[model samples]
Target: MRERVDKLKEEVCTLFTPSKDMLRRMYLVDEIVHLGIDHLFEKEIETALKDIHESEFASSNLYEVALRFRLLRERGFWVSPDVFQKFKGDDGNFLNELADDPRGLLSLYNAAHLFIHGELELEETISFARNHLESMIRDSVVKGPLADQVKRALRLPLPRTLKRVEMLHYMFEYDQDNGHNPVLLELAKMDFNLLQQVHLKELKEISSAILDDTYDVYAFSSIDECRTLNAAIQGWDDTAISLVPEYLRKFYEIMLSTFREFEDQMPSNKRYLVAFNKAEAAEWPHRNYKPSFSEQVALATETTGVRSLAAGVMLGMSDAATTREAFEWAVTSTDAIISCAKIGRFMNDISGYKVTVDVAIAKINELMEDEWKTTNRARIDNQAVIPVTQRLINLTMAIPLFYGYDSDGFTFGEQLREILENLYVKPMPI
Candidate 1:
């Protein structure tokens, strides 16, 4: 019997290792119904149970194995009532007891069964798993081989506790079908250090990729589109505006169309109604400009303004006058930077010595020096715009050599590249 059990264990391990494809296939509903029923007829339930017990199963893969066993029983494979009673009872209180058990492996397996079989609702399944996982994590029993198994079963990175928290947050925030406040509360208790590190690492990789691909496009097109539209509206050069790039022109047209659709869906007296009406007229000058263009531009401007103001407030720059000035400056500066990039001119045209490219560079340098001090400084939650503003400021400072302002003879692109290297590319000390 011992020799047979060892052989069976080896087979099961071999079947499951390196990948789960074979296990998933064998445990699927149709396969279980067919083979499990035949196995019951050929080998008694006691023999099967003995096989499982002697396997010395790894806890992580136990969930998958237990699920297979449950399917077998459900498919009319006979098992004594006593075996069923060991895990569940007539009252359904067995799950709660199992959840509280010091040995969480079995509980996790049972929870997986309830989850996969839809015996419990999605929220209930997630909650049960989270609670049990948290208990195991807090008990600190989830280490060594057990931890490896848990990580494998959960299909997440190690330090299972933090993964649980992030999963809970994702479920609560985005999984409309499984949102549960209690699970969120439980998640909040986890160590945020691990979570933040993981999140920031992911964001850094994504941001780097985006910057690499979109920096030139975003910088150039945003200016060209806005300037063409602005110039057309101001009646500066109708023929030049007509020469706008087809793709960008189409984007403006689509923006106008979508804005109109959105406005049409709104109720009367909504604040957006006023902007929508104005935007409709703004689109007329472009070949494809429609009445809705004004509405879309208005909407975009308002959204940008609100975000900028919120960012200012979050940064503790909430003085109403200062915040308003900063937001206005951000909008104008953003437009100007884009315009210059499109015209292929740098800071040569920008006025005001105090706020010039040189001053911006000095500010970035000062901020870099005091980056440590700003570690605990006020932060804006609207991360997208804050960094964009920082980049805009930096780019503004780096490009457009002032006429007598050093005349170092470095081309605009070269200067901008140097600035990006210094401000963004260099790795910060960890």
Candidate 2:
């Protein structure tokens, strides 16, 4: 399997040679990404994209242009959305000829999602392309991989969809493509199965969040019990465990023991940062605390679990660059971290039934878009470690998978059961 994977990877790299046409290269890159094997060829992919960028890529064909724009923008290149202006007719609308091509419209529709703030051209592009793509699907104008892709994009475009979740979908669709590369397909399946084994092994060691469940589900009748538990966590000692309710004693032990295990594995001086299990008990006193939208967002940002999870992820990193500074960056309330938390919280509120705000769903969605822009800007501006930055980005991207498109896949596991099965329980057929 290893020899096959290595040979397949070399063949995949050969596809990026300068002799390949720009459109063909772009499509291969997109497939590599969607197939979840891009991580195996990051340097090769980067070199190819840089070469493409230096070539002053341009195209009269709508599909080629849109694909180029999306591919460039997705990699932090500042490709202007105005590149699409040529496709508009004299009346300030997209050309009727463009609408007739569902393939090109689908490309443009998915590309528009990478828009930053005030890019009205891209926004208009979304509306124009979406209408045509939807019409095409309804009219059965597209079939095979394009058909499957357009339907999925209409639900959640490539940018927002989780990579792991999309891997199996793309693998199956790519299998149906007459032009698909056999080497790439084989590599994707092998890589996927290898990763699944690692994930399943790791899943065995991960216990449920007893403390969070205690606070959220197993509510205490006495508010003082909540206070005691919070204080006990702050104390970070087994002695404080006795002060909490009897049922919570085991949770505290598990949490403290877990942190102690983490501390033992780290440098002695840095062990202090391991006790980052702070929880707020103030909300317990007022169960009916109906906060305004702003208040809800602020509270949720703190309680959304991204900060601790990000920090924990950084702490566990074996990278030499994951230094104390990187750990500090993860725990700090930077714009990037705050945006991630807000995105998670807002998505959860929008999808779950626990929403306390009366704001319209559209309004919350708009706020999420603004937050996404902030996060994307932070991705460009932040000078943190590359591994840390990538980790934060991964954390943010995974949020949409669990709480995306007005569906709380986390809470209502049925929606994601098939996805999880594909990811963890089942391996791609060789």
Candidate 3:
């Protein structure tokens, strides 16, 4: 398998040679990323994209133009949204004739999603692309592979969707494309299966542990109960276990045992960073507090669990990749971490909350887009090692999969069952 992967990697890299057309190379780059094997060809991809960027590439085709724009911006290269002005007409709107090209519309739709603040061209472009693409789907003009791509993008654009879940979806779609490279497809399948086994093994290691909600189980009536519970967690010693109610003692003991297990594997100095103050996290809700929107966002940042998850992820990585400074950065409330937490919290709230007004939901969506821009900026500016940074990116991207647009995948397992099964249960056909 290792030898096969090496040969496949070499073949894929060759496809990036200067002889390949810019459009085809960009398409291959997109496919490799969607297939979740871009990491294997980082140098090849960077070289290809760097050449593309430096070439002053331009195309009359909307699909080619939009694809170039998105791929460049996604790689932290700043290609202005102004490149799209050519597609518009005299009335300051996207030309109606462009609607005939469903493929281009879909590409533009996906590209527009990468827009940051005040890029009204992309804002307009997205609205234009969406209306036309939905019309195409309604009219049944796009079929097969194209239709599948359209419908999926409409449901959730590529930028916001979870990487692993999107990879599975794209694998099936890529298989249907007549132009699909057999080597790339085979490599993707083998790589996915190999990683799936590793993930399944990790899952089996902790399969027996089931945690019940401590607050719900205790039915604590007052803030004092929460405070007492929090105090016990802070002590992190056997004597502290006696502070909580007798009924809660067993649960507390089990929790401490788990924390200690984690501590055992982690460096002693780093163990102090792995705190989980569930009791304090629930204080706002226990008091029935109705904070202003800003206050709510602030509160959500600390309680979203992203900070703890980030710390855990960093600690689990190699000490070389996760330096002491990197760990400190993870624990601190940096803009990147804060944006990720806000994105996750807002996504979860939007999924579960029963908001009657469309405007209110729109506001939340707008906030999420803003947070994404902040995240994108942070991604470009981050100084951490590539592995550590990619893990953080994966954590941020997984938020949407956890709490989907219409349903909370975390609270309701049904929505995520198929995705989880694809990742852990179903074997990729080799």
Candidate 4:
């Protein structure tokens, strides 16, 4: 599998005119990312994007300018919104003629959303592009991949939708078009479904464990406030903003309640994770004034949602003592816990931190392997525990996202329950 992946990646990198053809390379970067296979060619993708940013678009076409700005800013690179200046008229709005071009309008619409705190031009561009694109959808005589892409992106903007989910969506569109690369499309389909089943399997276990243990109802009241919590983090205001400090305080209270559960199962000294709670408690809001990538992930992991789930894992498993020790391993900021928390931060991006789940799970598997060698447990029980815990860490961060974001695949709470039962409990009729 690794060899096949490497060969495919080499072929993919060769397909790009990385240095000279800025537009084509950028488009390839976007497609590769959307296909959910960019991790296989991270350096190549990063280099291409960086070169495009430095060369900075050979064309002044709206799609070129918009795509360049959107891609760069979305990835956390420093790019100026002033680059959109040339696209505007003397009257200080996006060129009136550009509105007639559906593709350009769509590109601008996407670029507008990447604006952080305050950028008046990008803010205005969003309104202008949205109106034009909506009209394109309503009018007659124009319909194809270009128009369809606009419609889907309008319906579910880039920032809000998950990358993997979006890629799955794009695959359907790609399948219909003769323009898409056939070999790459076949490879992408294989990679996507393989990962999809892995995610579904983990999600099934997560939903089942949530049901068996009865943790769903407890988090319901906090859902609304947590949603507001996410909103405020984005610089948006809500009445629930008042609940921010209180909600943060109450988070530790929940952690303490879960920690108390470890008393019966864990050693007396290990039962109190005062330092863990204290370390997390100090960073109430994960993103501070000028937050870095590393800083944000560190703070996110400390959220009551992630930490509480670590506590719940101890209670959920059959071997209480071993689970408690594993929980302790997680709470102490082990590689497993930190990596898992980092991924949780991007739960919204769908493409964000998702790659990390496989990384974090791999680390936990390593830890489990080390323990397997040291302990004298029965082979059957030890094997069972590793897979279960691997899935647990994979989905732990995801569970917190239900309140703030929607899942394209699972859709609703009842749908989640049904999926778990169908995928794991009942067999498909052959």
Instruction: Write the residue-wise lDDT of candidate 2 on 126-168 in tens digits.
Output: 8888888888899999988889989999998877677777787
Residue pairs that clash (backbone atoms under 3 angstroms), model 1? 279-294, 279-295, 280-291, 280-292, 280-295, 346-400, 347-400
Top candidate when judged by lDDT against the true structure: 3
lDDT of 4 by residue, 313-376 (tens): 5554446345544555544544444445444444433422244466764664344333222221
Candidate 2 lDDT (Cα, 0 to 1): 0.75
Write down the worst ten-residue block by lDDT for model 2: 272-281
Cα RMSD (angstroms) for every candidate in the order listed = 23.4, 3.6, 3.6, 16.5
TM-score of model number 3:
0.86
Model 1's C-alpha root-mean-square deviation from the true structure amounts to 23.4
Cα error, candidate 1, residue 216 (Å): 14
Better of 2 and 4 by TM-score: 2
Instruction: Candidate 4: give the clashing pairs.
Output: 162-350
State model 4's lDDT: 0.55
Task: Please list the residue runs of candidate 4 whose C-alpha ends up more than 4 Å from where it truly belongs after superposition.
Answer: 1-6, 16-18, 140-142, 200-430
Report the candidate with higher lDDT, 2 versus 3: 3
Judging by lDDT, tell me the better candidate of 3 and 4.
3
lDDT of 3: 0.77
Per-residue C-alpha lDDT of model 3 across residues 1-430, encoded as one tens digit per residue? 8789889888988888885478788989999999999878877887898888888676889999999988877676778787888988888888888989999999899988887777777777888899999999999999997898899899888776777888987898899888889999999998888888989899988623333235434435655666676678678789998788776687778777776754554446544332343454456576676568887687667656676567677755666777767776766667878889898878877877767699999999889888887776664566344456557767888887878777778788886898889889999998
> Which structure is stronger by TM-score: 1 or 2?
2
Candidate 3, which segments miss by more than 4 Å at Cα?
18-20, 207-225, 244-281, 284-289, 315-329, 383-387
Candidate 1 per-residue C-alpha lDDT over 62-103 given as tens digits, one digit per residue, 9 for 90 to 100: 345445444333222322223323454566434555554433
